[model samples]
Target: MERLLAPVKAFLHGETPSSWIEEARRPERLAVVLQDHLLCELKAAQTAVWLLRRYALDKGGSERLKGWLRPFEDRVYRPCLVKEHQAMASEVTPAGLSCRPDAPLAGPLVEKMVRLIKEELHHFEQVRTLMLARGIVIEPIRASRYAASLMQLVRSGDPWVLVDRLIIGAYIEARSCERFAALAPHMDEEVQRFYVSLLRSEARHYQDYLALAQMASPEPIDARVREIGEAEWRLIAEPDALFRFHSGVPSAL
Candidate 1:
């Protein structure tokens, strides 16, 4: 665990504040946290799909990915179909993920992201199962500003755009891993074990994102990383109106 978190801690700009952890462990907040976390897993998988569609995959590959993701997507967007979607959780095999012949770094990108999507969807099912066992029904919750605010930094060109998105991805994954570590000890036994279990894959996801960003960039990305790191830090270290898995410090804490 130390080996996994050492780089994650170094890569991230700020740690999740103690106050947010305190607020999150409250009984009233568990449902909210798990709900948002469930959605976050879905969003993470969706982001990977977006990357494959835009940068790695051919039309057939993208469609196959979309079909695999539809049930998960519907589970979030259509809360009434929760039980229906639960049955399809094990059906996320996105076979035939063919990439474009001319797409640079397509092979590594496809391999890494395909693995990431599978893990994230699996995590989604795990969280959902926990919620069900606790009698927590899936409900709609507004997204926190953390991710959307970071994405505003993405540039509007080919390599620059991809580079910026990948850097942002690294930050998101790093933050998730860091928070999981921070929250584990405070959670109940079941939740703590689950959060701890996520640390390895989440850590790797951040590293994979950073490596991809660096590879896709035409030059050193230190400056760009520092720039985005600062933004991510502000989002974490500042006061936030809402409580979420990735939200900033809670004002009400």
Candidate 2:
């Protein structure tokens, strides 16, 4: 546990608040937390797809991504049977998706984004299965302010916009990794194992986003990274009314 804390501590600007964990550990709240986590994984994949389509891929690539998500989107757009979601999730694979060689940062961006989407979707499937086993209905909740607030800092330009997005992605991933590590010990056996299992991929996702940011940027992004990191810290450390998976301390509490 001490060893795990090292990387998680360095990854985020601030720790997951103790108040947040206290609330998260309650049995009454577990379902909501897990459901939010399950969908948050999908949201991460959507963000990756958006980045790929917006900056890394051509029209064909974008269309292929749509096809890839068609199955899971149906599950979220409207309530579907659990078996239907399972079957559709089972069919998600990156076999047919390939990067076009003609775009900016095409190779690294496509490669990493594709891998991220694959893993994130896989995680979504895993979480859904866990939810099913626990008799929790998979419901689509509205997104929290965590991601949107971070994205508000994104500038308006070509590579500049992409650079900021990538930086934001890094912060998001890093915070996810930190949260998993921080909350793992407080979770039940099944949930704890699941959270711990996610640490490696989340850690890699942060690094991949940072690497992509550097690749997309004209110059060094250390200063920009620090700037975004601080913003992320504020979001984590401050009070929030909504208590989704990545939210800060609950205001009402």
Candidate 3:
């Protein structure tokens, strides 16, 4: 476990301070943070779905992919679920649709992506449960700039495109894990424990995304990973225009 989590520890504890966690645990702040947390988890799951559907799955499979997200989408965004709890509530068990991985592309990419999708979905459910326990009302908010900024670095070609996307994925997972660790110290016992527990799985998700990126391209992925890593650091460290979960230091709204 130590070996598996070494990178995660280094990333989280290196620059992040102990005080941030202290602030995040306040009950007064819990509702706002939980709202952001809920959206972030859903976005993470959405991102995985987009990746697999765009790169690995066929057209027919991709349509099914949209169907898989329909339940949550309908309830939260579409207003079609009817029941009050179902309409405005989030699920405690993150939901996901199974993919048909037998066709077209077959490799570790498929395996890793599918596993990632499952984990992300589970994280979504966990966050939703936390929100429910706290009575944090669910509402839609615009996305943070973190993802868009990272994606701007993607190259304009096949292998490079895929490689860049994977590197971005690595950074996203790594940053999420890092933030969780940073914020855990300030959190209440329950939230703190949850964040700590997420470190291992989140660490694996980062590595898995990087490994897949390397597999997809013939070029060495290190330099590109480093480039993207620097970009990610800036995104986290610099001032931002939004306060969504992955947004940089909170800016004045």
Candidate 4:
């Protein structure tokens, strides 16, 4: 586990605040934590698909990708069929959408992002299955400012904007990896095993984002990475009223 997290630890400016971990450990907070986690997984997959459509895939490829995600999206957007959605989650697989021939970075981007989307959706299913087993309802919860704030740092223009977004993706994945490791020990055996199980893929997702950022950039991304990492650190270090998977330190704590 430590081996998997070494790069994640090195990449981030800070660890999840001990206060946030403490707040998450409370039994009452489990449902909300898992709920937010499931949502985050969907969001992660959605972001990867967006990247593929914008920079890698053709129109046909993009639409095909969307079809692949429909059942999962339905689970959230069309909540009337909650039981149906839960059953459909495990069946999601990669759509193998081809990339645009001329986009220089399309091949790697498509390959990495597709795998990322697949894993993330699988994670969504896993978390949702756990929630169902525990009788945890998927209630509506507000999003944290963490991702929106980081995205605000993305600069304007084509490749630079793409690179910046990829860098932000790295930080988000890295932070998630760190938090999973930090929270694992405090959770019940099943939850702990699950969190620990996620470390490898989450850590690789972080690396994939970084690699894509570097590939997209004309120059080195170290400066931009540090700049964005600093902003992500501030977001985590600040006090937040809403408790979420990626929220800052809990204000109530």
Give the winner by lDDT: 1
TM-score of each: 0.95, 0.92, 0.82, 0.94
- What would the per-residue lDDT of candidate 4 be over residues 49-135, giving only the tens digit for each residue? 889899988888899888778778777778775556344434444455767887888888887988888899889889978998999
Report the candidate with higher lDDT, 1 versus 4.
1
RMSD of each: 1.7, 2.1, 4.2, 1.9
Q: Give the alpha-carbon lDDT of every model.
A: 0.89, 0.83, 0.69, 0.88
Segments of candidate 4 deviating more than 4 angstroms = 81-96
Candidate with more favorable, higher TM-score: 2 or 3: 2
Question: Can you write out model 2's per-residue Cα lDDT over 1-253, one digit (the tens) per residue?
Answer: 5565566568678888999989889899998998899888888989998988877676777898877766665666655532353434445445555566667587787778888888888898889889989999788887779999999999898788999999999888888888888888998898999998988888889889988999999999999988888999998889999989989888985
Instruction: Give the distance in Å from residue 196's predicted Cα in candidate 4 to where it truly belongs.
Output: 0.5
Which stretches of candidate 3 lie above 4 Å from their native place? 1-5, 9-14, 17-26, 79-105, 251-253
Name every residue pair that clashes in candidate 3. 21-186, 22-186
lDDT of 3 at 31: 78
Candidate 1 C-alpha error for residue 163, in Å: 0.5
C-alpha positional error of residue 233 in candidate 4 after TM-score superposition, expressed in Å: 0.5
| Residue 233 accuracy (lDDT) in model 1 | 94
Backbone clashes for every candidate come to 0, 0, 2, 0
